[model samples]
Target chain A: MKILVDTLGADKGYEEIVKGALKALENHNNLYLTFIGNEEEIKKLVKNNTDKINYIDTNEYIKNDEEPALAIRRNKKSSLHLGLKALNEKEYDGLISCGSTGALLAGATLITKRLQNISRAALTIVFPTEKNPCVLLDAGANMDCPPELLVQFALMGSVYSKGVLNTNNPKVGLLSVGTEEGKGDKLRKDTYELLKNSDLNFQGNVEARDLLSGNSDVIITDGFSGNVLLKSTEGTAITIMGRLKKGILGSFKAKIGALLLKDVLKDVKNMLDYNEYGAAPLLGVKKAVFKAHGSSNARAIETGIDAMVKFVENDIINKIEKELAKKEIEE
Target chain B: MKILVDTLGADKGYEEIVKGALKALENHNNLYLTFIGNEEEIKKLVKNNTDKINYIDTNEYIKNDEEPALAIRRNKKSSLHLGLKALNEKEYDGLISCGSTGALLAGATLITKRLQNISRAALTIVFPTEKNPCVLLDAGANMDCPPELLVQFALMGSVYSKGVLNTNNPKVGLLSVGTEEGKGDKLRKDTYELLKNSDLNFQGNVEARDLLSGNSDVIITDGFSGNVLLKSTEGTAITIMGRLKKGILGSFKAKIGALLLKDVLKDVKNMLDYNEYGAAPLLGVKKAVFKAHGSSNARAIETGIDAMVKFVENDIINKIEKELAKKEIEE
Candidate 1:
């Protein structure tokens, strides 16, 4: 399978991206990649992995501070824009980028376009929950979503959960302040009504406090709130871990205890780490598009590539299209 | 100081509430309390400490499932309603309730009335953070707030932080999905402008991830998002601690390590516990009102009463009123 990789805009630089791409290529002998970035630097980094790799020579990229839509529109030769263009026109099965999320999302939507009957595409992530990894969307793709858009997110998240995450009959829950019906703001209340009417396994409303309890297989929220949820979870984990480290070092006995429990703590850390989970899929697009975290290390990139390959293999695009079409017909 | 305690609607039952109130009364010899619940039961609970205590005999109370506004308006004799009414009419210094948050907020707003120039009341919580305990407003009060209301929240939050929490010139922040200026939904964008123009120490937008980092002294958001942030942090902490406990119990060596680090873990748990933090103050109301968590045990209720005493001692309600009035005059 051919995949396009935008080897720029990541915080760690392109060398790490090249290393990760090479590792993915080594693991999947059948995988071919087209790298879009500074050609000379990437070539020097890639060394002998030239057979299955192609290059689009351009150092142009979108900065994090630039307006996303305007940057994509103006910077035609930028790695993110070119990668999306290639993914749309070429035979590549998917595209991966560790770029500015806004630019990548904007380029993907404008260049690759949305799937038929899909109102807006959503950024879907598999977050680690107490019971299992649960699917959450729109993780900062569409900021101001109407109730109808949330309904679409629920449908797409359900498809992604079942088709890619391998959850059978995933339970979809709307994120709200309270778990009871008519508990949240207007968006949540309206979305609750639509979700209850849909064919999906609607689990009513799920409070934010129940987010990590693994109460629902698929959770849907507006991009703004979803982003808040994802980031809050990340920040809280970091703060707690930092405090624990401080506590462990402050006392001699605790230091000894920490040394003995090092392996167990490492396992817990790994379970909560975003690197192990790979990239978040930008669902509802006509083509497969994955966004790796900007600070992703080489290992994270390799895992992200693996996740993208799964997306391609599962034919999530076609499945999403079919699902949306069926829903339209039902309506 | 006279305080009104609504000994009903708590998940742990009135016995816990009575026990907590009695404990508070014992600690503060100058403090007097009026209990609003089942008269006979409360009198029996407060048998020896009857000197500084009074009773309003009534078994009527608001249930968790009842609509908050409706219940408060219809059930005049309910503990929550009676307490709020007494707080509004009598010489009570403050009122504390472990009741439905909606009912408490509605009754507080309608009966006690909002401070002059205050458009709406807010539920404010003092949450533990990395640096210090920071104040967050509109925790679950007004879910659908306009830009103006959020501005009021920021003002009230700043006053409460400086007056009660003792943060010197508290840094006020508007909560959003991103920390950058103009990086969130319409409410955030509009609120950003208002906060910028206001006299309060307006730090720009703060991302939810930074909520626990203590980047700002006072964080303000619409109730919906604030609740999501609060609950998400709580949920993530619970999930992590649960996993750590399971990890500790899974191996003999880990268990030994945990025994050594028992005090350290307990300290961490206490730091993150809501019970230790006390009840959330409902700001902007004419009188001091506090909402303890529904699941609060005796310890939490004692802490809640202690916090309410501080609120009254600091005269936060009048301070908030002055701040709002000053802002209005400046405008």
Candidate 2:
């Protein structure tokens, strides 16, 4: 499989992105990468030139402050726009970027276009759970969503879980304030009614507290609440872990204790750190694309590349298109 | 001061409730308590014939499954209903109940009535931060709120932080997906405009990740999102702490390390425990009312009573009424 890698917008600079792409290439001999950025900078960092590696020059890039929809329309020569345009042209099987989320979503929808019969694209994250990682979608794609849009998110999320996460008969749950028949606000109640009658394995309303407990394989909500849930959980974990560290280092006995429990601490850290998943896929787009973290290091970028390759190999985008088309036909 | 206590709805039974009330009575010399529940059960538990502890007979109680509005209208003899009715009649300074949240909210709103100029009653929680406790409002009251209602929440939350939490010129922030001026859904954007034009100390949009950072003294949002945020943080904390404990006990080295850091762990646990604060106040109501956790023990119950006493002494309800009236006058 071939992938287009946008080597800009990351906090670690071009060196880390290049190194990560090279490392990923070393592991997957059948995979090919086309780097999108400054050609000279890419040449200076990458020592070896092989048929597997390619480069596309684009000095311009979209900034986080610019309006997403307008920037994608205006910045034709920018790396983000150009990289997505290349993928749209079928130059590569997938695309990955650590750029402005707004710009990426706009480019993915407006430039590359959304999948057939899909109303809107959703940004999905695989949150780690006690059993396995669950797919949570519309992470921040559409801030305000109607009931129909949320129904689409549930269908899309289920497809991603089955295709990428390798889950069979993935259970889809609507995120709400309660687990009863008629709970949550108007949007949720309406969405619940729609989902209950759908073909997916619809588990009734799942409370936010149960979102992280592995109650369902796919949890769907609007972008605003989903984003808040994602960020709140992350912030709480960071704060608590920080407190735990400070507590351990506050005394002499605790300091010694910490040294002895280093392995266990590492294990817990790995369980909480979301970067282990590499990137969050922006699903419902016409092609396979991912948004890596802004502060992604070499390892995280390489992990993202591996995931993108798998997304292409698994034919997730096409699978989503087929499922959505089937629904359209039934409708 | 006089306080009305509902002796039903707790998971632990009448004996625990009686013990908790007695414990609270021991702490306050000039305080009187009116217990509302089964007359026989109360007589069996309370051996004291003191005039300070009084009882009212009520055979019925609201269940969690009953519709809130219907239950409040129908279940007149319920402990919750009778307690609220007693408080509404000016028989007590304040009220405390660990009953169905829906029933409590309905009883408080319908029987006690809302404070003048207040749009709706809000459930307020004081979340402990590194610096101090920050007040979060509309926790689960109104699932869907208009922009004007959110502005009221900000006003009420600020009053709560000032009167109860003792913060002067408290910073009120609108919770949203981003910190930008025009971020979040239509509700947040419109609320931002209303807050900016209002007299309150309005801080622009605050991300959910910053909710626990003590960045703002009061965080305001619609009940649906607020409930999700509250529950998500709680679930994440519980999951992480559980992982930490499991990891520690899984190995001998870590077990010894944990033994040495027992004091530190205790400190961290205390910092994260919501029970330390005892109860969350149901603000915007005419009376000082609180809803304790259903699983609350004797210590938690006592703490709730102490808080009720403070609420009456500070005249928080009256203070909120005055502030809200002043805002209306200015408008």
Candidate 3:
């Protein structure tokens, strides 16, 4: 399978991106990667030997602060825009970028366009829960979503959960203030109705308190609520972990125990790490697109590539299209 | 010195509620309590109670699923409604209830009424952060709030942070998806502008990821967003602690280490415990009204009573009224 990698906009810069791409290829012999960035820098990083590596040259990159739509519209020569265009052109089976989330989503939507029968494509994050990793979307793709858009998010999330997470018949839920049917505002109530009538295994409304209990495999929400939930969870985890580390360091007893529990703590941290999950798929785009965290390191980028490989090999895009088509027919 | 305790709707029965009231009075000698609920039930628990404890007869209680407005209007005989009425009548300096959040807010607004120059009353929660506890509001009050309502939330949160948390001139922040200006949806953008112009120590937009980092002493957002953030944080904390416990129990090494570090873990748990913070105040009300957690225990109820005593003794309601009135006059 062939994948396009945009080597810009990540926190560690181009060196880490190049090393990550090389590491991905070293791990997967069948995996082919097209590196899109400055030609001279790529050549220098690879030491003028671009064996089994396809290079696409582009020095310009979109800034994180740039207006997403304007950046996509204007930065035709940028690596992200060019990589997305190439993915849309079917030159690569999938695309991976550690760029700004807004730029990536905007570029994927405007350039690659939405999949057939899908009104809005959602950005989904697969984060760890107690039982297993669950899919949460839309994680900041379309902020002001209507009931219909949320329905589409649920549908897309279900397809991704089944195809990628191997969760057969993923239970879908609408995030709300309460688990009751009529608990939330107008949009949530309307979306709850829509989800209830859908073909997926609908679990009605799921409150935030139940989010990490693996009550539902797929949790659908508007970009605003989803983003808030994701970040709040992230912040809470960081704070708790930091506090734990502080506690261990503060007392001699804790410090002694920490030595024996070092591996256990590492396991817990790894369980909660987003890096292991790799990239968040921007589902609903015509082509497969995955977004790695902006601060991704070499290891994270490698996992992102592995995730893309799975997406391409399993034909996730085709499966999503088929499921959406079936839903459309049923409707 | 007088406080109203609604002895109904808690997960525990009246025995626990009465015990909690006694515990509160035990902590503060000057505190006088008026227990409002079933007279026979409370009398049995407080059999021959001393002079500080006063009893009122009421058996009615609001259900969690009952409509807030309808419940407030029809259940005037309910403990929550009657307690709020007494608070409004100046019979009690403050009121506490471990009842449904919707019922408490509705009763407080309709019976106790809002303070002068306040259009909406916000529910504020104080939770642990890395540095210190921060105030977040409106946790679940006004679902769809205008920019002006958010400004009021900030003002009220600032007063609560000062009067309760003792953070003088508290730095208030508008919670958003991003910290950058003009990043979030229209509501957040507008709220940012309103907050920037306010006299309170406004600290601009704060992302959800920085929420538990104690970036701001008071974080203000619309009810929908604030509720999602609050619950998400709570859920994440619960999930992480559960995972840590599970890890400790699964491995012999971890179990031994956990034994050694038990005190540290308990300290960590205590730091994150919601019960330690007592009750969330329904700010903007004419009188101090606190909504204790619905699933509160005797100890939690005791803390809620302690919080009410502090609010009443510090004259927080009058202070909020004065600040709001001063702002109105200045405008």
Per-residue C-alpha lDDT of model 3 across residues B1-331, encoded as one tens digit per residue? 8888888988877777788878888899788889898877777676444788887798889988898789988987888888888886746788888887898888888888888888889999987887778999989888878898898888888888898778978999888888888877778889898888889899888999999788799998888878899899898888788878888888899888988888888888987888888889899988888888877878888888888888877888888888888888988
Worst 10 residues of 3 chain A by lDDT: A43-52
Candidate 2 off by > 4 Å = A47-49, B39-49
Q: Candidate 2: lDDT of B185?
A: 90
Chain B TM-score for all candidates, comma-separated:
0.96, 0.94, 0.95
What are the runs in model 3 whose C-alpha is more than 4 Å off? A26-30, A38-51, A323-331, B38-49, B329-331
Write down the RMSD of all candidates, one decimal each.
Answer: 1.8, 1.8, 2.5
lDDT by residue (tens digit), candidate 2, B95-160 = 888888999998899999888878889998888888778989888989989999898889888877
Q: Which order, best to worst by TM-score?
A: 2, 1, 3
Off by over 4 Å in 1: A47-49, B47-49
Candidate No. with top lDDT: 1
Model 1 chain B is weakest, by summed lDDT over 10 consecutive residues, at B42-51
True contacts kept of each: 0.86, 0.78, 0.69
Give lDDT tens digits, candidate 3, residues A1-331: 7889899888889878788778888787787778999878877777432566798898888988899889988989998888988887655788889888888888888888888888777889997887878999999887778898888888888878887789988999889898888888788989888888878899998888888888799999988888999999988888888888888999899998888788778877987798878789999987789898888888888888887787777888888888888888887
